[model samples]
Target: MSALGTPRPSPLPAPPPGAPTVSAPEPQEPRSRKWIVWLVLILVGGLVVWQAAVKPRMEAQAERASAVSAIKAAKVFAGTLARTVRVSGPTSSQEYTSITAPIMRGPEAGRELTLLYLVDSGKIVKKGELIAQIDAKTLEDHIDDIGDDIERAEADVRKRRAEQAIETENLTQTIRVAQAELDKAILEEKASETRTVIDRELLKLAVEEAQARLNQTKADVAHKLQAHKSELRILEITKERHVRHRDRHKTDLVKFKMYSPMDGLAVVQMTWRGGEYGVIRQGDNVTPGMLFLKVVNPAKMQVEGQVNQSESSLFRIGQKARIRLDAFPELNLAGKVHSIGALAAGGWRQSYYIRNVPVRITFTEVHNKVIPDLSAAADVTITEEENVKQLALAAVRREEGKDVVYVRKGDQFERREVKLGLSNNTHAAVLSGLEVGEEVALEKPAIQMAALR
Candidate 1:
């Protein structure tokens, strides 16, 4: 329809002289342009081949060669697939002990036995019972010696008295002779009769004899009295020394006896570590305060364990625990927690590394046969969550702040962070980030084989 008139084209003015004019380029030959476009495409194709094909294949080959090994890796993933945390720890006795009546014994130290009769092993002794008798024979011998000394002292006194008596008689005879001579002179002299002076020499000799005799007798008595008193002092000193020796002998004899300090159960002391069943013997050179055996109160008992601090989060006071005795694991003893340590048991230099405090778990209830100090393996159940969706434990890996897994969709693999609940060696409970019937990589020691096969 050419109903209305068509608009006509309008012509513009021409360019001025000496001014340059703008014009479009003329079309190139089709054959030449086609070759140019093909060459440019080839160059671009080569660059893409270098990046997408050759580079990736080279990297894959290098990775296959350079990759080291599978775990045995310390870092293991924690899958929320476990039902519980199971640990094995040794059982310990609450009342188990190496007891001895005398704890005070050592090398180059010993108790002396003069005659330790009746203090042998296996002797049941009562409190204040006489266990042995030390030789008090020395004291008896000293007493005998003192008796002899007394006899000798008495004989000396008798002999000295006899000598004094003999001297007294001799002095009396001399006095009588002097008196008779004086009497005779008196009868004859009488005033004019004093002319008896012609016999003065005889009278003088008689008087001198009497005086000498008396002086000799007196000196003999004084010497004998001094000797008797001195000997008595020696006897007194001997008596004191002997009494001390006797008392000491008695004390030593008392020490020779071993008795039960406490009355419950008696067990002999261990000669060495790991020795058992109470096999102490007589003539073992035991000393005073040496504990050869012990009696225990079995009613009270306890268990002890030392756990690594790294696993401390798995522990809490009052948590339920189970114990399996190495000697009796089939028993499956049940227990509850009573306490835990607030401080580490050992020092940095301590054998157990006191640097990390030991968490002590006690069996709140125990079987009677599960005696205190009875060594057993303990499992502390720190936490438990039930009725949760659980999966194979191998699928979980502990990541920076949470549990994670590699989730597979169709043929592509992607990372999925998961939230965990409870776990055991067999399975872990899935709390979130995963669904039922979804296939998750086991991520186990054998996981590498899935890719290889």
Candidate 2:
């Protein structure tokens, strides 16, 4: 208000000396609050986007990745392909000697024989080596009893001969006495001229009676001699019967001790006893004629296997085979088909049309580890080829009457038709369409399944 009606400004007051200065906080702007709200909304929107779209996309991508990873694939290779007729069965010997329990005769017949001694299974034995022994005690006792009977019969024979000698001597003495009596009567008849007629007639009658008695005595002696011979014959026959019995028992006793007839491995066979089938052990009783052991000539070893009737045509005598022992995998043997059954055999429980042919494979190469009854497999090579490109049979699929393989190209498989040549169980020859070292899916691609879904 001092100069042209305009008010003048006044001067501010200063703080007190030594007092602390105080500052007030500035107020926040509305634009700043708006910016904070927009930031929170953006974060929420980002979370919603992750839940509805981005995460699902990532999950689906992971699933696709997993599906792609799940597909099994293999690379093709070039090698020899052998088409083989595979057969499986227990190993056996082509030239083996079988030892069985002896059929007991005489007193010991109709009874099981007890095993007294058994050689260790799989023992290498020479020809004539003792492989097993049955209890010979029974047969031995039987032989002893028969011997006693034979001895008794022999003694009876001798005694009867002596008795016959004594009886014949007595008869001879009787005949001599009768002759002397007849002679005395003859002398008395000669004195008949000095006696009465009655006395002479009586003397003649006495002579006649004496002569008849002498003849009767001689005839009786002849009959008695025949009887003695017949009695001796009967005794000799009895003794002979006993002797035969003893001999038979001795033979059976000898058979009780079994011997290996061949120079090879001695393998005990399983026998049915006590309602179960098992190897014959010491003290185990076995029926007569039951096969108890085998003397297997490993030199002539073979594998006896069954082949499907349809596949029997592939086998022929002298065809080469490769044998592998399941017990010893390291042993690979060369063999040849030696024999095939002329008839097909089928199990009663199976279909009548389902038949199998027995095939015999003789081993060309011998290994010590090869033995009888071991589970073995034979691959009889029917045909073979070299430098053939092949893929697993599973990798090839039949489509529209054509062989197609799923060839892997990057992350996907491309279906390709391939020309095939000779094939086997495990692999198929790739003649044209497939190349070596190319990966092919062994199974259906999971990527294809996902696409279909």
Candidate 3:
């Protein structure tokens, strides 16, 4: 019977009259098994082909796409790379003159002097301009008193001299009168020779008496003259003393009027006063030898900065630099390292742990905007080597405790170790293991998970 459950046809007219009626052979199990085996073999062969060729090709394509997307490349170059040190500080004049309180030594040492008048800070002063005035009223009054004393001493000296001269003349006249009396007595004694013995004896006694009086008068005149001369010497000494005092007072008076030693901008100095710190101004009391003001030459300016101890070794005198003022950023000035501190000092605002070395950079060209105490930054080119292989800092990577970079070779990247030298923020000097014009990976390339699986 047909598998469709349909009725079979009648036995083909009984298989013709004499035809032998042969029974159909029963279905063979071996034949059916053979056909099933053939179908399984075809499917296995197809799967083997896909695994061997198609699948591998697809994976390779995916990996190529990922590498193209993830990896960034840069070429190494041979050029000059500058190693620079950046520091910031205030601008100041290379040359400045200080104005200090006049020091009166000896008995007046340590005296606090008051400022009666002060020129406004930041004012431009020409050479010889009056910049300040100390409290000179007291000094002036003292000078006037000294002048009076000097005048009085001069009068006294003249009076003493006149008295001495008059005394000397009177003594001279008295001595002359005594001499005349002695001579007249001598003559009278000679003339009495013809007289008797008693008369001659009287004459000789008179002559002796006259001679003694004359000698006494001469002695008195010498003593009086010596005493008068001594008095005159004392008066003269007194007058000279007054004159010296007067001269000293005059010099002190001149000190009270302060003048600018050179043309510059005046900057008032900070002072400790009234138990606090503040700038010096009019009516402020200052001590002797205390700095009162500064006159800075604006034409010659410098940037006074400090370099960190770590970077201090790179700095040296005569290195070129670029200065930028924070207040006037538009102004760019060229400069050079003028000086470096001999020893490291405390960092700004006393940052104890991080020490710094002071550096002074003098400007090459003068600018009007440059002034003292303006905040400025300096970029000092410490080392500049030409024709050296260099690479971008991003291209360098650290791996396994060593400096490394991914060097591109054809379509694949290989990891290589590199020796490095001086470096700045943007670029690094390549000491070895890298060549100019070679391409390197800036970042690691991505790997495909499907390909790995």
Candidate 4:
């Protein structure tokens, strides 16, 4: 044992036997991890390729197949086909009375007529009911003045007649007195034989003088009588003129109170005032001959529409129509064309090149919701066919100067030519080359396939 506290290392024993010189086994080299990293990288690369390229391509192919199988198509059907022209305008009563401001006469003429009373708009009124009244105070005053003038004229006529009678009576007395004097003179002349020659000569001259005076007096009486007749005639003519004037004013007074000519709904008219168009109300000043209101019979209504000149030929009297009021969505009434204008007229607010023909449609059925001046649209049937083959317009395609449709045949669409008759916006009447229950592609099959791809 060593003196120090540390113990000595133990010595290895030598391999004594020569069976094998065993050396310490060499440390085997550690396997590399690079192959495992490469394998992980390879697997990651394959995953990226599948997500970015393979999956999207597979999805696209699936969608293309679905679109090719899902092409939209429709079948030709037998139905009632009608060609209609849409006309829109305002609805109005067929029977209506236009009420205008009364034209004043006499001194009130040319003056602005003020409305004193006005009925409420949209009021139901009976015939002969007062609808409006113009301010007649001025007119009434003028009439009174005319009446006074007429009275004065009549008085003057009577006074002139009395004066003429008195004058005639005095003239008659003068004529009688002159005749008596002439008689006295003649009697004196006859007594000449009882007197001397000088006395006889004086009596003869006195008789001649008296006779001349009587003739002159008679002439004066005739002239004065004629003059009196002329003066009386002038007075009578003046009085007649005043009476006629009064009568004219009386007629005008009656006009001031306006009445409904027929039982109807009273609708006030719009007038231009205060720089804008508005309804005429009480206290508004209306001019002579100006239309202020209307009395429209609601039971008898019509639509006044104007159609293009090109379409005028399609419209004729007695054509059936379906009317729709824009104000009331639920009301659909039947009507017919009542009249068509013989000559087309150009609208004042439209272009000069545009001409429209006036059309009137009378309602065959009355509805309580219908009212005058409401905006309405009508479908006038120009031609109609029942139980005819009709095809959807979307199914048609114009190709090579002809109309063609894609008729479905098994798994393919065959392009087929078709003859079209009456056509509207949505469908066309198939006159030939198409049968009922045949399916036609709404969209081009080739185009839809290409678009999906």
Using lDDT as the yardstick, the better of models 3 and 4 is: 4
lDDT of 1 by residue, 123-156 (tens): 3344444443434355346445655665666666
> Which prediction has the highest TM-score against the true structure?
4
Weakest ten-residue segment in model 3 by summed lDDT: 444-453
> Per-residue lDDT tens digits of candidate 4, residues 250-368?
88889989888899999999888889988889999988899989999888999999999999999989999999998898888999999999999998898988999999998999887
* Arranged by lDDT, best first: 4, 2, 3, 1
Q: Encode model 2's per-residue lDDT on 148-199: one tens digit a residue.
A: 9999999999999999999989988988998898899888888899888888
Best by lDDT: 4
Q: After superposition, how far is residue 351 of candidate 2 from its true place, in Å?
A: 4.1
> For candidate 3, lDDT tens digit of each residue in 290-323?
8989999988899989887887788889999989
Q: For model 1, what is the C-alpha lDDT against the true structure? A: 0.54
Itemize residue pairs with steric clashes in candidate 2: none
| Model 1 worst lDDT window (10 residues) | 67-76
TM-score of 1: 0.45
Q: What local distance difference test score does each model get?
A: 0.54, 0.85, 0.84, 0.88
